[model samples]
Target: MSSRLKRGIRRLCSTLSIPLLGCAPAERWEIPHFEPWVPEEFHPASIVPETKTVIVIGMPVSLPAVETSPSIWYHEEYRTVNTLLDINAYRIAAFLNAKGYPSVALPRDGYGHISVLIERPVAFFSHRHAAFLAGLGTFGVNNVLLTPRFGPRVRFTSVFTAAEIPPDPVLEDPLCIRCMRCARICPVHALPGNDYPDGLTDKRACASRSEELLRHYVSPCGFCIKVCPVGDDRKLYDRETMEIYDERKKEFNRLHRAWRHVRNYGGGERAPGMINKTPPG
Candidate 1:
């Protein structure tokens, strides 16, 4: 692809409300690092044989909203972001196709539902891996991609095309600081507190919690992302302090109260003991 067309694709992402975009050669999937880690069946070229480039786009899940996770507020925000990702990716693919480049957009989450994840947590495709290969981020101890722009609080989608767009450089430095906050704060003890591969999340436990939360209209427990201290977003939102996550802290009572109020109104009413009412610290 010409530099001008690549720039246009980026501008298109920005216009569609996507703030992060990157490209990677499809063959990056077979490199020494990813070759043994991700199976051949999952590779971009295997899925789309004409693929030459994998385009990734991401949108930040507002930290303030993520802080209220397991509540209706964060649940809606998550859905909205996923929807936009799918839409933006489809448009980008369409743009490439118009230029005579065979292109296809992949769904943000390939699973049918949270229940499906409980039985089998793996997705057909992995956007987190795609994001890392595209230079948008690196894997965290929590087993999610951690970007400098939004830490683990970002959602990603991908587009595959025959057009060989210039690929972004692979990030050489790690973004995760390994504070272990994600491991410590997990309510279900999903994260094992070790770096990626070795510390892969206990998907069954994590998915079970999400399945239960879905019954109450709030799913996808995001405590790991919420507690992560990476990202420029922390500074922008003035959330540099970890103490704010502790509800017992008197100073943050007002913030806690607001989060509680949001939780109460939407979703099925929490019975006497359906789920923990308090947000995980």
Candidate 2:
């Protein structure tokens, strides 16, 4: 790619919060191979060695930040975020399709045909990493993918094809310094312990804890996003401020509970005209 084109692509990827740096050629990480559990049809004849096809797109999922609210307003916000994510994903898919590259949105269900199986040995070759290979973004310490725009706030889906596309070399950042802020913020300790080279995590433990939390109606805990230091102002949170907010949330919940009890058992009567009031004539 020309330097100017490369820079433009980097800027686009960054705007989406995908770290283009980690996808730079000099920093590409080798993916380990494993036997396919089930084989899918591979069309060697369809492979265009020099045609430059296949584009993987990452999809965003709603962060669990506002899930504590009982307000319908928060539910609407959740839907809005989800809609934006879907739109962004399909936009990329459409762009690739228009370019004559067959594209599909890989499902985010965790077990779709091209699912990102983080626990499996083949996870290093996952769709997220494929996007990383495609120069989309870098991996954050939370074991979740981080983009320059979204940080770790997004999930991923991908598309694959047999085009001879020039691969985007992986980018590396010396400034990363392995800060463990993301691990500290993970609600279920999904990240690896501090002392491993490979840094694999206990996926089942993490998933089970997330499921338990979701049962309480917190769909996806975004504690990692609250902790990542990179990204623009809107997505990033100050650690101290987040801590203070957590404290205040606990206090409010306590107060709400006490008020519920009083309203249920206390003999306090509704104020005059409050029980059933009509507009003034």
| Candidate that would win on lDDT | 1
lDDT of 1: 0.86
Error of 2 at 58 (Å): 4.3
Clash number for model 2?
Answer: 20
Q: Against the true structure, what is each candidate's TM-score?
A: 0.95, 0.54
Model 1 is weakest, by summed lDDT over 10 consecutive residues, at 271-280
TM-score of 2: 0.54
Q: Assess each prediction's global lDDT (C-alpha) against the native.
A: 0.86, 0.42
Residues 56-144 of candidate 1 have per-residue lDDT tens digits of: 99998899888877788888999999999999899999999998989999999989988888788998989999998999999999999
* Model 1's TM-score against the true structure: 0.95
Q: Write the per-residue lDDT of candidate 2 for residues 187-215, one digit (tens) a residue.
A: 55677745222566567666564444334
**Candidate that scores best on TM-score:** 1
lDDT of 2 at 134: 59
Residue 94, candidate 2: Cα error in Å is: 4.7
